[model samples]
Target: MKKLMMICMSLLMVIGLVACDDDTEGMKKVGIIQYAQHPALDQAHDGFIDALKDEGFEEGKNITFDDQNAQGEGSNAETIADKLVNDGNDLIYAIATPSAIAAAQKTTEIPIVISAVTNPEDSKLVKSNEKPGGNVTGVSDLTPVEDQIDLLVKLAPEVKSVAVMYTNAERNSELQYEIAKKALEAKGIKVEAATVSESNQVQQVAESLVGKVDAIYVPTDNMVSESIANVVSVTNEHNMPTIVGEIAMVEKGALATYGINYYDIGYLAGKQAAKILRGEAEPKDMPIEYSSEDKLEMGFNESTAKKLGITIPEELLKEAKIVK
Candidate 1:
């Protein structure tokens, strides 16, 4: 009878261990790989985390996150993605173009949701925004390039020649440059291309444009955005105003910017992630989203404007979020 009781107790303990294992398996794991540690990317990460929490998947509860940043290096992006895939994450959130491309290349089995990427189509990440046609979809930071150029023209009427500076190797920057070239040409504004392949080249690129153009326009190219202080220092030294692609550029002393809020775009991406998590939708089924009107913000740096001795017209100021 004692031997029979021992066998039953052992069986009960085995059953309890199996139940605990099943319970632990209920939690989903997510991996987030950001291309760089910039303000815009950081805001997106924060927004993504916040959105997940709002969706009832608290970080330590039913969800686990493996977040990593590539520190603005393309090679680092690939390494991070590979690590995430090897770790067997249920879903991957890739921020920025390089990270997205890296993650997509690493795995098609795991769903990838990208944020802050300007042109998903141009980057060949998706077939279309309506139907992504793959295991990848997310939010776009593709603020209307023409609208931003128009704002630049409006801000600097004397800007007959605009110097467009970007990293030549960046696909997103090339895409923006192509669109801006046509738009600026349509307005009879001569657009000069100042291309750089590295962050150190930005200062030389910006300095080279000093006498060649009336004003400079910096796109949201990762290289340029990451080293904007260098570009700003050069442009400011020339007393030339700059119209930037992201709001953080304005905060870094760009004269003005008509761009989408990175945080808000990330929040939108996060909402899409929630849908995927709940199994309400798949990444491939969900169309990529952009910031709505409310999420778009235009910021102007008054100090920078004053430093450049450029008076921002009252009309543009009315439309801008003045940054002190």
Candidate 2:
């Protein structure tokens, strides 16, 4: 009788544990914090949602999303991150470095899947890229800066000197600028640089580079990308060819770039989020992912090319996506 009672109790405990697992069919809550409203970040956010849908976590059916935007403010990102953590989110998808840093700071318990962050370790969101060692893991949007510099030279052989403009506060932009500077110098191209602390200062800073350099190279800095029209206004008037860090920036009027697709990286991050939500994986165990180089695209601006009176190489034109 005693043995039968113990066996019955063990069976009941096992049933309760299985029932408590996250694999059970239940509604999940996901919080998304986007750092800004630019095209790249917007596409990332959209792709993240699409990936969740494909993973059987459709909004309003199995999952509910608490989407918040920081509007390019660090304080706002922190506030939103706090709210999401307090709300008991099943998982958090942070778009951009600022938002990811905010979410990682808010809670170490909640699973965090980040996108658009250039360096997770440098940003202190993860201990390392291979093994995150914490509750954060996602994709990095580290575009090929060396190849991009080479592309700039190919498009405009006359560019002997270039201006590198970026936002000072963005760590990702700062890192890319350092890499770009080295690459430019290696090709015997002189490099001038400028930094903007805010969007309102972009035009003035861009104007400062007018007579100093032959062309401009802008990285995937959120603040600079948001105010890209201002930079282009100056470049267009000067007939200067600008090489940007990503395709969206090319679409915004920069000359060209060998950049990764923000949507693809975001989709990869979303899949990580899905695994966490279903209790199939833990953030610390998942290795950080990157968009495959084969997925990189050469993007050029048609109108900008014509405006600058630059001739496109037949080989490049054959493989590039011409954005008018």
Candidate 3:
């Protein structure tokens, strides 16, 4: 009888050890789905991971991260989302409208946190900003359209006609174009839109606007942002001044940009994720937050400016972050 009792105690100890192992393995797992590879998106991801670490969820320790990039292909985004879901990630962090849409369609139960999305409502990912009314909520990179238009008028006083280029298929692009048209029109600047459905069409659209408009404005549309180099080359070749939606574009070649710091926006999203993880708030109860501060940076490519025979405004130069 004593031997049997000792054996039973040993069996209970083994079961307790197995239970502890299961609990340890059930630690939080997160998956990040990025729409494309770009400086802005990269910074946002960095900020998010940094925020997670700051909150004590270090990757490969208490948490695991599965990062995937769609490489600018929408179909690839869907595939990545499926894999992440199959992997049973506790949460999914989708960075951009396309990525968010892909993840949202893949799972209704998994909590999705989207960052750097321009217009969630227009993307149909949410019913409204006030109440996302779904399993998704995060930060927006919504640049002030009216403020950007005002900056353009100030930078180039002689600018009469402004040409805007974007991808027509992207809902964010269409939304930004509408805002740009109204804002520029209010300033008595005639706005012309050049739409492209693919990357190959970007150069042609940029070429079509050469010598026709005093300045060109490029919004934070994913398609246009991804093909900015091609558009910038064409615009520079034609000696046309360009305004951009994000500072990264300005650093690339644009004359000036009024937009948000994407990294900070990502950090904000990370904070929201922490809240969700702590069970402090529900996704539907959380409202989509916009960047509180906007940054105005000038990228004066002296060589490009001189090559185009355009003089950089001294006042603007004084306020510029980079004077090339």
Candidate 4:
């Protein structure tokens, strides 16, 4: 009777092992490649995960996420992209332009949803915004460069000249620079420009602009965003008000900006990922999405304003969201 009981237990163990294997095979995997560790990108990552959760893709159950950060290095992003592609993720979420470009170069089979990328077509990640023509489509965090500049004028009416600071390596930054230069010229604001090839150069570059320009215009450049503290240290000392491309910079110590919510952009991209995972759509056919104009909000740093002795205009203060 004891021998018979042991045999029965062995058969049950084998059945359980088979069941577990089947469950593992059925689990879907998603890989996330974030370009940097800034708050804006961090918010986007969390929003994407929350979106997947809301869509019933519960972690440790039906889905798993292999999230990797490139540590603001392009090579790291390329390596991480290769790993995600090799691991056979059902879908990949890329948080920045570099990460998205890395993943797009890695695989055509895996659907890639990107957030915070300015111009997909310009980046060559997609054939066109209207038709992706490949397995890459998501949300763009393209802030209104003109509107942001106009907001700067309203906040600091004394700004007769402006310095545009950005990292030269970023294609999107270059794109914004061109538009901003034209807009600044159009508005009759003399534009002084500076570029940094590396983050370590940001502080020196910003310092060089001191006393040369009345204000600084920093676009949503990843390197500049990551090294914003360095930029603000110089600006704050000079009481220079820096108008930025996104709210995250304002929160970090820059003066103000009119931009889209990074979380909203990520959530929208997550929804796009869900549709592809559900077989309801393909990325190639999915039109690239953008945050609605209504979603853009003006953000101000009250502490920075007070430190710079720049009085916030009453009407503008009422319209802007003060950073806590």
Candidate 5:
């Protein structure tokens, strides 16, 4: 009789644990904080949602999303993070480094996932990329600076000097700039960099580079993306060729880029988020992932090429996506 009673109690405890396991199936809230509105960031945000749906967390059914864009302001990221936490979201998806940093600062309890960040370790968002050792983990879109410089030289063989511009406040931009300098110099290309104090300063800085360099290289810097029109105006006037980090900027006015697919990285982050949401994974143990090499695309702007009076090679056009 004593043995039978003990077995019955064990069975009841198992049932309770099973019930707890299904908690994620009912309803969930996901808060997304984006750094700004740009094609790369936009693709990431959309892909993240698609991935969540693929994982069976459909919005308005099992999950709801509270999406907010910082519109290129750093301080707004922190405020948005606080708001998401106060609203009781189950998880926070921070797109871009600024938002991710803000989210990490907001709460250690809430599982924070990031996308489009460069280096989690340098940013202090995670203890280490391999172990994380904290409540934050996500995908990084680290720029392939060396490959980009090679592309620039290949596309414009006469590009003796390249002007690089980025926002000074961004650590990732500074890192890429330093990388570009060494890479370009090795290939016998002179590298000059200008610092934009803020978005408004991009134009003056860009205009300052006219006639000084043969081509310009723009990194995946948020401020430059936000006020890209200013840089575009200056470059177009000078017929300067600009090689950027992604397609959207190339489409806008830059010459070309061989860069990561932002959507793919975002989708990767969402899959990780689903694991956390379902209680199958914890932030501390999940390793940081990067976008695969095959996911990258080579793109060139035909309209900008025409405007600059430069004829793209037939072989190059066949392989690259020509954006008009």
Candidate 6:
């Protein structure tokens, strides 16, 4: 009789475990990986979470998230992707080009959503933007680089030479550098470029541009964006006027940029994620979205301009967003 009771107790324990497993069957798991910490990327991540909530996937209820930040390391990004995919995450949101590519490389079966990538095709993270042709699709923070350079020219009319600095390892920054170089050259301005592979080199690179160029320009580079304060430190000491690809950089001391709203792009990516989670769409069928042209806006930092001894035109200041 005692042996019989032991068997019944073991069976009851198994039933209890099975019931607990069944209770979680209704919840969805999402894995999010960010390339680094910066205002633009943070805004994108926040927007994505908010949009997911808007789509009825509330945190701590129907959905759970495994969020990881790569801290600007490619190897770390790959490891994070592997853990998220191998651990059976239902979806992945990659917050930058490197993070997106890492997630894409980790699994083809898991639905992967990307945000803040400039050229998805050029990065080879997707087959095409219109139709992903694979398990990766989302939003692009493709700011108008040419228009930004035009605004920079107008902001610094007497600038005859400009230095473009970016992380050499990031193709997104390289693409912007090419555009900035071409635009400045077309206007009879000499263009110089400095490339850094990581954050430690940003100060050296920014210092290299001092006394060599009339102004400095930076694109939406993950590495550079992550270490922009260091760049600003060097540039500010030299009284160099710097233009950037995003408004957040203006707050960090870049003189100006006419850029896209990163938050909106991330929210759009979350919408695509919601559709996939709801069984209404697939990543392969989702077309990547570009930040609308209407969302592009001008920005400038008065403090940085003042330190650089650059005068902002009253008209430009009136229309552009002031970065405090």
Q: State each model's CA lDDT, in order.
A: 0.88, 0.91, 0.84, 0.91, 0.89, 0.89
For candidate 5, the 10 contiguous residues with the lowest summed lDDT are 18-27
Kindly give the stretch of ten consecutive residues in candidate 2 with the minimal lDDT sum.
18-27
Candidate 3 per-residue C-alpha lDDT over 10-51 given as tens digits, one digit per residue, 9 for 90 to 100: 999999999888867867889999999999999889989998
- 1-324 per-residue lDDT for model 1 (tens digits): 999999999999999999888867978899999988889889989989898888888877689999899998889999999999999998999999999999999999898999989889889999898899899999998877787888887777778899888889888888899999999999999989999997788888888887888988888888888889898898888888888888898898898888888888888888888888888988878898988877677889998888878787877777778878
TM-score of each: 0.93, 0.92, 0.90, 0.93, 0.90, 0.91
* Worst lDDT 10-window in candidate 6: 315-324
Task: Write model 6 residue lDDT over 1-324, tens digit each, in one string.
Answer: 999999999999999999878868878999999989889999999999999999999887789999999988889999999999998999999999989989988899999999999988889988987888999999988888898888888878889998888878788888899989999999999998889976788898888787899888888887887778898898877877788889888888788999988898989999999999999999888888998877887898888888878788888777789876
- Per-residue accuracy of model 4 over 1-324 as CA lDDT, tens digit each: 999999999999999999999989878899999999998999889888889889988999889999899999999999999999999999999999999999999999999999999999999999999999999999998889999888888878878899899888889999999999999889889998789999999999999988898899999899999989999999989988999988889988998999888988998988898888889999999999999987888989988988888887788877779986
Model 6 quality (TM-score) = 0.91
Off by more than 4 A, model 3: 1-23, 294-319
Better of 3 and 4 by TM-score: 4
Per-candidate clashes come to 0, 0, 0, 0, 0, 0
Q: How far in Å is the alpha carbon of 176 misplaced in model 6? A: 1.0
Tens-place lDDT digits, model 5, residues 171-244: 88888899999998998888888888777788888889988988899988888876676787788778788888
The C-alpha local distance difference test score for the whole of candidate 1 amounts to: 0.88
Residue 316 lDDT in candidate 1:
73
Query: What residue pairs clash in candidate 3, if any at all?
Result: none
